[model samples]
Target chain A: MFSWFANPHRFVKLSDWLVPACYVLAAVGILWGLWQGLWIVPKDDYQGGDIMRVMFIHVPAAWLAMASYLGMAVMSFVWFIWRHEVADIAAKAIAPLGATWTALCLATGAIWGKPTWGTWWQWDDARMMSVLFMFFLFLGYMALRAAMDTRQKAARAGAILAMVGALNVPLIKFSVDLFTSLHQDASVITAEGPKMAAVYLWPLLISSFGHTLLFAALVMTFMRAEIWTRRAAQLRARLMTGD
Target chain B: MSGAPILSAFRQALGEAWAGGAGALLPLGFFAGTTVLVPLGVGTEPATLRAIGPGILWVSLALSSLVTLERVFQADTEDGALDLWLQTGAPAAAIAAAKTFAHWLTAGLPLALLSPMLLLMFQARASGALLENMGLYAIGGIAFYFWGGVGAALSATVRRGGLLISLIALPLYVPTAIFGALAMGDGPSSASAPLFLAATTLFALAAAPFAMGAALRLAAD
Candidate 1:
């Protein structure tokens, strides 16, 4: 599977059909989720009524923010060990998406929190701070890549960074948890608890699945464009050398 | 491998740091300047200063460590010292560690020793407690220098890479800053706080050298 997907042509061919299919499915899933979340489900009074609906957007974005960071790191590892250009392209593609999802997560969480937690921001909140830090890590990876003068240096530096970050994500999370616990009782997420009804659970799960599809589709599209741009650059170089 | 490589690298780094006006002292200046700004920026209420002081100091120390990292590998890369070292057949990881250890010794250690002064500025007393907080700064120093060194090495060959190094290092500084704050906070200071802070320090100590080594090789390329 590694070598199979390692080929840029294969990726291009596969994503040609897959990308469109994903777009349709993601649109369906997301629209249905938004519709159900906003209008269908009965908001519990104890859960802060209408504001809890933001969970459909916030929870999925939160999960995908983390998932895509790991995905980028995995791609970086693949490129680091195998020197597959496609893996590098995939990783480069994923960084902005992961960052965007993280931003969405933060924004929606803040929106959700204003009423529930009584504040728009809580610096001591472990989850908020961890996700915020992860967002910076993603941006740093991109900035590091851009700083390198050569593509190879950029890939190597970015790979080392992504791996280092992936290793520390758990430790950062744990330390943030410790820091918060020792300092104060952060507005616990236990307000609604895990006793979520099936009505709320199904939409949340489906919306997460849809968001995952959308994120994957976006990554594929970016990778495809990058591959084409590289090919064009190579052709231009060849022509310039011949001339 | 023998300790020769680390010892030599550490010695050479210390020598260079000393001759270069001991750039190690530079972070202390920045650390102090930042401490001065915090009270001015936040106003000089003793309670407010005391409450926010630990966090602000840990964060400033983390930032101050970053200022010196821009030079960590840049000087070696510019002078071709990196090529000479790599050709010496030494383990790259060891060399990276030694230099970073030396960096901590110079830049990070002074900041750690001066933590008492910072605490005093925040209205802290108790000489015994002051020394303990200084030790906490010592461990926090390890995390800061090693992780920041990884960024410095990665950006070593890039011209004007100071901002890039800060971008890369700041996120990595999170655990150190967080744990150090926990260790220093008067509220519910767990015995485990220092242990967790040490764990972050040790984690960075173990991991960052290899990353710096890899990045140094890339810089040499």
Candidate 2:
């Protein structure tokens, strides 16, 4: 199935409609989520009161941050194994976006932390530290890719880094947990279920889904732009040969 | 089929490193220089130094290990030694392991041996436990080199990869440093820290060579 879209022309044709649809759905979901979260949801009695509104953005961004990397890693695996140009392009496109979401998660987390935990950054917090390292992992992938001279080499290198980082993500989380015992226990979002009321939970869920759609839309745009850029470069090379 | 090539590769790497005398000594010099600068920069207050002693030592080890990483593959690749190794039909990972062993022998081993004295210079109580400190540093230093070798291998084709190598390797080094430092400290937690530290080294030993081998192949290509 993925092999069918491995061709750039097919991918472009598919994404032309898919990207706009994703953007429209994302915009509606995000707008509705924001309205519901900001105005309709009541203030938390135990937590930061109205400031808890940031959770709608913060939680969704954090989820997408991890989700984007997982997506990149999967794309990287596809590229590494099949040598798919589209997969490589998709992986490369996801790096900066993933990094941005990771940053957004960190910034909003810090803002939320300042009020709730009484510190802007907590070194001992496993979630915060692991997320910070996740950001670094993304930076390292981008930097390694940028430093290489050839596209193939860069893609291969980036693929390997992404795979290694993906493997280490679990280890990093575990190590951080072991190295520091202090952590904010999952109160609202639990494995059993979300413990929050429907008003807050619905908005958070919608926002998380909206963020996923937005990320998909953005990735499609970047991948399309990458395809165009490569085409132009090929054309330029041909013109130079003709001259 | 035979161990001769691996042994020769290791010997050649070690001899080349030691001949410069600088590669062997550079990490030590860097370790000592950084240690000296810390007191001057942070003040000679013994209590403060004692508090941060293990952390400073690990950070110094990390930085010093990074100092020699660029040369792990740069010199070999530039001189075609890597190509010769690749042609030997020995797995690239095996060659990487041999080179990393050579690197550990020259750069990491010395830092491990000298860490006790350095710890004393900072008035760290770990000076009394020289054997334990040496053990921890040896394991931790090897882990550093193994992981750093991955970065060095990845960046082998890049021009002036020294800083880039550090940027690539340092994040990977975090677990080793954390576990190693924890092991060196005096507390209830110290018992488990060394075991975890050893686990980290084993993890690096298992993972890095394959990554390095792949990167080296790409560089050779």
Candidate 3:
């Protein structure tokens, strides 16, 4: 099956149909999640009653943001070793989306923290710094890629960085563990499973899945654009050569 | 060049710092001005200054390297001297070592010399902290430039490379900053940290030349 999808044209054809389906699923899932999280789920007694609901989207976005970078890092290794153009394009496409997800995480976290944690920001916290570090890494990666004059060179530079920046992924993940910080443990990726009640948990899962689907669909759309753009450039070059 | 790498590197560093016109001197000038500005801006409280002195020293070291890293191969690439370096019989590592040593001598050494003024400007009183921080900064500066040589090598192919050079160099710089800061910590220095710093600096020095050389070949290719 991996071999079957190895062809970019075949992958493009497959993604065309799957992309719309993913969008439909993502839209339905997100709407259902928001409705359940906001209207149906019970409020927390410790924090502001209704404010706790924001975790449905906020937590999922944070997870997906980090996940996307990890995904990009993996693709970078592939690009470096295999020299796959698709891998490079995928890595490039995920960066902005990952950055957006990171921003959403920070913004929503701040909003939630304002009522719960009693502040919008805290510096001594490892989690906050890790998030900031992720943001910087994302910006740095994007800047590095754009700084290059040619696509291949950019891809090469970006691939090396993505791999090296992989070092930061674990650092970000474990910062809360290693340091005495305000950031909480992994709610979803834990071994003992989620600690939240089923009512709150269900919406969280749906929203997280919805975001993942959305990310996949967006990446597919970007890949299609990149492939088309490259082909168009090639055609222009051919015409210039009077072929 | 056939003698010990240490002597050859030192000689080359001294010679190359003043080579190829005045552009090489720009980092030295920039380092001097920035160091002077630090003292002037921080007021004359010696104790207060000493507390923040190490941090400021490292910051200048990093920025000074940033200014000159572009020149490592930037002018050479533009003028085609880099191509000749690539084609030379000398090992790429030797050339990388020479360039790094030259970078440290011209950029890093001047920053180290100017650091006392900046520290004095902050009103640092402790001579021990000053000397220790100075030593750490000098060694860290050499380590930093070697890593930066990798960035410069990779960036030689780009037109406006300064921004990308910073992106690549800054992440690798965190450990140096951390160790350099820890080395100047309040009590007797932490045993682990200085050892770690020395090991990291040696690693960067030994490993970066090869990585940089490979990157240069890739850029050339």
- Residue B165 in candidate 1 has what lDDT? 87
Candidate with the larger DockQ of 1 and 3: 1
Provide chain B's TM-score, model 3.
0.82
Number of colliding residue pairs in model 2: 0
Q: Please report how far candidate 2 places residue B170 from its true position, in Å.
A: 1.5
Q: How displaced is residue B19 in candidate 1, in Å?
A: 2.2
Better candidate number, 1 or 2, judged by DockQ:
1
How does candidate 1 fare on TM-score? 0.94
Clashing pairs in 1: none
Model 1, B78-161: lDDT tens per residue?
888888888877878889999999988888889888888887898776579789888898898899999999989999988898
Model 1 segments more than 4 A misplaced: A179-194, B1-5
Name the regions of candidate 2 deviating beyond 4 angstroms. A179-183, A187-191, B1-4, B126-128
lDDT of 1 by residue, A124-197 (tens): 77888899999999999999999888788889999999999998899889877754421223222346654557
Candidate 2: Cα lDDT at A82: 95
Model 2 chain B: ten consecutive residues of lowest lDDT? B124-133
For all candidates in order, the CA lDDT equals: 0.87, 0.87, 0.75
Fill in the DockQ of model 1: 0.82
Query: In candidate 1, how many Å is residue A2 off?
Result: 1.0
Residue-level lDDT tens digits of model 3 in A58-139? 8888888779889999888888887777788889999998889889999998999899888898865667666766776778
lDDT of model 3 at position B58: 81
Q: For each candidate, report its DockQ versus the true two-chain complex.
A: 0.82, 0.67, 0.31
Sorted on DockQ, highest at the top, how do the candidates line up?
A: 1, 2, 3
Clashing pairs in 3: B46-B123, B49-B122
